[model samples]
Structures are given as structure tokens and as C-alpha cells.
Target chain A: MTSFGNEPLFLGIDGGGSKCRAVLYRKDSGIIGEGLAGPANPVQGLERAQDAVLACASAALSDAGLSQSQLGHLIVGAGLAGVNAPRTRAAMLSWQHPFAQFYLTTDLHIASLGAHDGTDGAVIITGTGSSGFSQCAGQQRFLGGHGFPLGDKAGGAWLGLAAVQAALLALDNLGPATSLSQAVLAKTHSQDSTALMDQFCGQPSAPYGQLAALVFDEAAKGDAVAKAIVADGAGYLSNMVLQLTELGPIKVAFIGGLGGIWQPWLSDAAKARITPALQGPEVGAVIYAQQRYTGEHAP
Target chain B: MTSFGNEPLFLGIDGGGSKCRAVLYRKDSGIIGEGLAGPANPVQGLERAQDAVLACASAALSDAGLSQSQLGHLIVGAGLAGVNAPRTRAAMLSWQHPFAQFYLTTDLHIASLGAHDGTDGAVIITGTGSSGFSQCAGQQRFLGGHGFPLGDKAGGAWLGLAAVQAALLALDNLGPATSLSQAVLAKTHSQDSTALMDQFCGQPSAPYGQLAALVFDEAAKGDAVAKAIVADGAGYLSNMVLQLTELGPIKVAFIGGLGGIWQPWLSDAAKARITPALQGPEVGAVIYAQQRYTGEHAP
Candidate 1:
């Protein structure tokens, strides 16, 4: 394989629990190709994640009309879920790769960098789980990304779990009856808590998280229980964002599948601080790769 | 297979999720023999539950100096968990048995009867789950006992889940920090919500319910979060009991492993209506068997 005369080809990858995406770029040519593949999170398995990344990159290469041997001329950066763990990161870093150079970081980290043009800022992610990160003055403060039943107060799983709990309370007439309870009962085909528990307890976190969208829908229609849950969740997120401001006047971006759904619920002060992200995590990966590759070449 | 003419031999069995207990009695004598076996809840498996009940009864017979051949001389009554489900009850009723006569009822049904001396009264079972039953004026009213994450407001699982949720909020500085959070973190050896969620989410309801004792213990020592959880639970139970009173002035007994633990938290009005149980579900099973056998004999 020969270097393409310092044309500086780049492959940027964003790998998450749901999917892996790659964007291939050439300096001054912008994005030349893009590819998509199945889930590539490390928790799924090192081999599976690697295969996903390779397949996505290969597709991007094909899209760019490039050959396999050209891989040796490319700089690569990956922002992936479950890469925050030391063991996972170390394993990926040590793995054999054909790229000219490789850069690795968390999906959250890349999203934050991209949100603020690679400068200091904060981001709150409320997808299947919830968490927030604020970087300022060369220091970072993290909050609320703990996962379901722990810190994901306003996250999808938390919302669904809380909704189920409330529905049970309503069924017993221990709390006010609401339409939210009826909806859950209908979905589960359960007339009471015993049926509901027997059916739902054995399921993993995803089914519970899926119910969160229904809750938000009910809240929009003026269901008291759903409204209360949404308000409580919003309160938690608002407090988190307000605390981010204490570190510095950094722009805060809400980023995640559920982030846009919750945007209207955030406090006015928090909403005022919010800014649109300039690009997706994949673009962030590209920018990150460019910066790191340039720094190495400068010296 | 011959009868012990005019001599009544009684076997009362209480089958629950954890274990099965059998007591043998001769008409003129009090408890003459006792035996124990493993969990006999039919939900676990009809075969396994049946085997547990048989093993427990056989042990009691051995203690009473009876051979397997003497099974035909005994009249057996069982109050078993999962028998409340019609399918389980019908299956057990239809199964072959060697006893001279056999009667079946739910653990909750017999618990109510035993607690109130075979008379009209009520019982709220607050063990790993919560459920209430009131039998008065020849009618029965059932409430709450929906199992974890659905019902069981003041039940162990609910308390533990609430404690974990609180600990995460405390960790995020979104809520008051308390000793309960410290205790949970210490027990799970989890430093953050992510670690805690990964550890706790996979576990079944029992482990979560077990942590409830810790929450109550913390509340006793004045942990604000613990106190709030306990109070919220008590509020739910209070509402349940008050609704039960709407039927009439019936005596109420709290039953099960965790029943006594929550007694002190009952409201004064609720406490005033409370009464000590006359006997346990096993004894109630014996009494029920005697009544049925005598009624059969008369005609």
C-alpha cells in the first residue's frame, strides 16, 4: 500500500447500541461516502463490534470507489458506546488495524466536541438512559447518566417504570385514577397488578423504555399522572443543566433520541442556554481525527 | 386403606413461596406432629409444589408414628400459594391423592380465616409482596397484593426499589444525601449509578425486597430519604385499609413475615381496628378441614 501523496483521507465512525455509521472524508473534498451497519457496542462482544466497524468502513470505501489497499492511507476515529470502560478502550486500542492512525473516544465525548465546535461545552443525553457532561476550564463535571432505576430519572426507562408504578397505584384506588393506567393495562392486556407484574417483571429494560413515548403522548393530552411524571423528570434535568452553568457559561446541548421530546419541558433558563449541535457524532469523529492527525504532522 | 372408625386424624398444610409446613392433629389432642419442606408454590411448578406438599405431609405422618398405608385415615387441608389462580386450584383439585378427604384454598384465604378465628374479619399480607383481603357479611373484598413494581406499595421490594432510586438522586445532588444511600452503596459496592444499575437490574424481586429491611432500619435511625419512602408506603397502606373499613366494622389482622415490621407505622385509626390473629393459616386449614369433614359426615 502506498500513501496517496498526503491527500489525508479520513474515516469517522459512530458506533452505538443500535447502529454503526461511517463517513469517509478527503481534505478539501468534504464527505465523499457514508456507510451504515448493525450495533457495534463493546458490550455485544469485541469481535462483533470490530466486524461492524470494518464492514461499515468497507462500505464507505466502496461508496468512495476506493480499494481495500487504500485503508493503509486513511486516518480513523471512532466514537462508540461502551468505550468509556478502560478494558474495552484498551482492547480496541491494541487490536490490529490497517489504518494510518486510529483515535478512540466515547460517543458522548464526540457529541460534546461537535456540539461546541471542539471547544468546552455541556451535553445532556436522554435516550434509553440519561446522563449529562459539562467540560470547562480543562475540567469535566458529569451528572445523571447512571442508567435505569439509578440515575436516568427522566430517561425512557425511568419514565416507563414510573408510569407502571403509577398505574398500579391507580388500579388499587390508592391514588387518583387516570387514562395512563388504562393505556398500560391495554398494552399489557392486564386487568390488575398481578397480571401486569407477572408479565412485565421478567422483561429486560428495553420494553419498559419503549413505554416512555406513550407516557409523553398522554402528558400532551392533559393526563395528570403523566404530566406529573414528565414535570418531575424535567425538574431533574433542569437542575442538572443549571448546575452546568455554575462551572462556566458553556453552551448546553440536549442530544439523544428522547432529547428533542423533552426540550419543550426544560425550564426557560435552561432552554435559553441550549444551542443546536453543528453536526452528528460521526462528523465530530471526522473533525476529531483531522485535529489529532494534523497535530501529529505539525511536529 | 382402612378407616380409623370414629377417630378423626387431621393434617393441615401451609404452602408458600419459601417453604411448606404441615401439622398433624388427633381430635382430642392438640398439635401432635409437625413437619417442613421446601417451597410449594404451584407457580414454580405443579409437580414440584405437589411433591413439596406430599413430602411435608409424609414427614408429619412419620412424626405421628403412622405408616404410608395409614394415609387413607387422614383428612388433609392445604392453604397454598398460587392456588388462587383457577387453573392451579382446578389442577390440584383434580390430582390423585390418598387422603380420606382433601380440601384446597389459597394461602391468603386460610390466613384470613386463621387470623380471625374462622370468623368474619380481614387480613393484609405484607411479605415480599402485598395484598389485602376482607371477608365480612359473607362477602370477600380483595385489594393491593399485585406483586412487585406494580403493587406492594409498602412491601419489601417497593421499599428497596425506592431506596435505590433515592440513592441515585442523592448521588446526583438532586435530592438529600442520606445514610440509606451510603448503606446501599456499601452493600452493592457500587460507587455510581451506572455501576449500581448494572448490578441491580438483573436481579429478581427477592433481592430488592430484602434491601427493604435496610431501608426501614435506616428510617428508624432518621434518614430522611428512608423516612420519605416508608411514609409514602404507609400512606398507600393506610388508604387500602381505610377503604376496607367502608364495608363494615371488621377486625383487621396484618399477616406474613414482614407484617409485624410495618405494624408500628399504621395510622392510629387503622391500629385501633387491628386485632391479634387467633391462629395461623395452617391452623385455619385444620379448622376448615374439620368443618368440611363434619359437614360431609352429617349427611
Candidate 2:
């Protein structure tokens, strides 16, 4: 575990909309330290994202009992949330950094890397948003990452919205009453459908998306409406997987906050094919750095 | 068409988000004049809406060869877009106007009134939003009508969004490439899925909803993806109508800009039950005023 041999250090940063996390590691010593900070999604705010990145990296170095002078020995990889936005990604890449070398890519790409140990595989993300990413023989393909209310059919936001719609319909006597609807009605603090519509129509997609977990929980208890939503979500995911498999017979992984909830509802074929990730996206970011820069064999 | 008899005049106004229309009528002369003005949706701007309403009314008066002072002889009925919003309705009702009497109701309510001739029937409004409203033996039952992105499943915005999603998937080689996708890509000025997503995700629901007509047009041309989207939209509409009919067997009328677009795709049962509106929402407004303010029988 000694670093006196001038061993090279690696840093991986996973910067999402809500928070940023960094991992510092070495081949022999393994993970030496980790740091976390607020959102570092450059599309939201480049300055804020940069600040989070610097703070997390510095904190990680401090936890590893290192100083700014030691930055020269570290190579960094950042898998960021908004790296798909060209302007944001370009701006982020041009910023001055303390690391010896830096590689930047999307959070989805790194998640795929970590899930398959930097090999050819696919990962379906079904948290607040829904998307699929796959890498096969160095060629990458993306699917279904559209944001809430438009796409992300099986994502948290979509589930929550469906729950609210079901509740409203039940209240209107257009659909059967279910616990999921009742729960959503209560959660939105509306006594009736009209009140809920007035309130819900004014809010953004995030709050409804936050209610997706509640929908899943209610479905697990056998609420018919909830089950229907879950089934629909699972069907969308299955379609994504089926579409991805057409490229090649690649192993697939499920990732994101809502990942586990979708498993029970997935098709038997998808169930047999889906595999757990080897590690988190941060480790994937580190692995990406190692592969793209260090030329070191996967650990 | 002479006003020499000093017969009372009626003005029916349909004020929506994009435009305001008014028709001036006399008991003996029928509709004497019509006028159009800018949007008067109070939810968007109370002042602007008030202006549009007033301007349209004034223009109608002028077209009818009447003067502003003649407003004292006129009764007004306004079927407005945001009359369902309590604040907007209340504010509009409280405004000072020259009309001898004023009746305010939702555009949907007026549309229903016009479709059913103020009888026991139903109307499904499918444009930017989708909703079913029925009056059965004086008991009003409202279904769907959830605004864009959350509820309006079969509406324009929903169709456009589904089209975009299909286009992106097709571009990704996850689905069959179709004319709908190519047109959408060209319309959005996007070279590929990445650019399309980057562009599409930034726009609001209105623009997407506007694209819905294109989907219907493509569906008419036998595009596979477009046909699928149309089928799905029709299915949602059918479900809405079927749910509405559970209360009672009644004729249903479809209204809105995209209203007629759905007719060919409706189920045979729905087609059998569907009927045309005898008049427009403005006439419905006028009829509403006559029914509520005067002792006139529905005509």
C-alpha cells in the first residue's frame, strides 16, 4: 500500500445533476480515498460543475494524505451528466485542471464501462430517466434516453405521472379506484381531481418523477393500476433490450435507482440475460481512465 | 337585418389561447356579423385576454352596423379556454363590461353544449389536449382532458412526442426507419439522433404538438411508424369513449383542430355512436346565455 515507489495514482469522477463523487486509486493499493460534492452537471452551470469537480478531487487527494503538488502523479477521468451537450462538454474540457492528464465522457458511457468491465455489453438505465447504452467491439450505441413527459416511458417520472393520471381518472369515475391513485392524490395534497389537476399542471416533471417509487411500492402490493404501469415500464425496457440484442448477443446489465424494481416485471428472456454490474459508475470512470489513457489491463 | 325594432342582440365569444372569435346575432336576423382578434386566454395574460375579448366584440359590433353604445342592448356569452381555472374565471367574471348580461363557461363545456345541442350526449376534444365531457340527465361527467406531457395520451403533443421517439429509435437502428422519422429529422434540422435529441429536448410541448398533424398525414400515406402512433392514439381515444359510455348509451361528437383526424381510426362501435355537432361552440355560448339568462328554450 506504500506510494513511496512513485506509483501512478488514478482518479475517477462521476458528476451527475444532484452530486459529484470521485475515487482515487492505485493498481496495487486499490481505492485510497473517495470524495463527494454537489452537482457537477455542466449543462446546469459550468462554473458550478467545475467548482464541484475541483472540490471533490482536492478532497479525495486530501483523504489520501496527498497535496496539490501530488496532482502531477494523478491521471483523471470524469464521466459527467451533460457531456453529451457539445458546448458544455467542450467548455468543461477547456477548463484548467490540476491533474496530470484528464479524459472526459458521458456518465452513461462510464456506467456501461463499469457494468461490463470495459468490454462489449449493454446497460439499461431506468431511474429518473430511461436510456440504454451499449459498447460492442469499440462501437457504441445509445437508446431511449429521452427526458420525462416526452420519452423515458418506464422511468421514474413516467411511472409517477401514470400514477397521477390513474388517480385523477379514478376520481372522475372513468377508471377503477386503486391504492396507487389514492396515494398519489394524498401525496399531491389534493382532495379531488380538479384540485389535483390545478396543482399538478403547474409543477415541473421532477416532483411527479419523485413519486415513481411510490407507484412501484403500491404495485408490489398488488394494486391493479400500479401493476399495469409497472408492466408497461417493463415492456418498454424489454423492447429496448430486444432491440439492442439485434446488434449482437451481448450481455446486458440494469442500472440506476429504479433498476431493482423493474427486475421482477422484466421478461424471462431479459431476466436470464440481465447481469449485475461489476461496480458503480465511478469505478467505471476509473476503469475508463485506465483503459483510454494508462493502457493498463483491466483490474 | 335592421336594428330599427330595437330587438335585443346576442354576442357569442370563443376566446382561446391563440385567438378570439365573436359572432353577433339578432333573434330575427340570425348571425349578422363575425369578428376575429388575438388570443385572449386569461391564464396567459388577463389584460391581453380582456383586450382581445373587447376588441373582437367591438369589431363584431362594427360589422353588424352597430355602435359601442349599443352594447347596452347586447347580452354576451363567453366560452373561454381557461374558464375552468377558478382565478381566471373569477377575474373575467368580475371585469366591467357593457353587455346587458354575461355568462361564462369553459370552452369544453361550450363545445359539449354545441355538440349535444345542450342535450344528454358527449363530446371528445382532441387537439393539444384530450378530454371527454358528457352531460347525462343533468349529471356532468368529465374524463381525460389532462394537459400535455402528463395526461393527453392521444392528443397532438403526445402523438408528436411518440413520433420523435420512434424517429430517434429508428435512427439508432433499434426500430424500422420510416418516412415519419425522416420528415421529423428534416423538420427539426437535425442530421442524426444525437442532434435531434439535443434539439428536440430543448423545445416545449406546443411545437411538438404542432407536429402531430404531420404524423397523421404520414399515417394517411401508410408509413409504418406513423400508423402505429395513430393506432395507439385511436386506442386511447376509444378507451376514453368506452369509459364515458359506461354511464349511459349516448351519441358522442369529436371537436378541436385534430378532431376529425381521429374519426377514420375510431372503432366501429364508436363510429356508429359518433355524430356531428349541429353548431359551433360560439352558438353553444349564445345558447348557454339564452338558457341561463333568458327563458328561451334550447334551439
Question: Which one wins on DockQ?
Answer: 1
iRMS values for every prediction? 2.4, 2.9
Can you list each candidate's DockQ? 0.50, 0.33
What's the C-alpha lDDT at position A44 in model 2?
A: 78
* Model 1 TM-score relative to the real fold: 0.89
Candidate number of the best TM-score = 1
True contacts kept of each: 0.57, 0.38
Candidate 2, B-chain TM: 0.90
List model 2 lDDT by residue over B1-299, tens digit each. Answer: 33534666788888887899999977777888888999988988988988998899889988988777777777888888867767778998898877787778888777878787777778898887788877777677777766666577788888888888888767766568999999898788889867877766756668888788889989999999899889978877876777666668777899987889899998887788788987898888777776776664345
- List clashing residue pairs in candidate 2: B130-B145, B131-B145
Tens-place lDDT per residue, model 1, B1-94, is: 2234647789989998889999997877778778899998987788888899889888988887677766787899898887766778898888
How much TM-score does chain B earn in each model?
0.92, 0.90
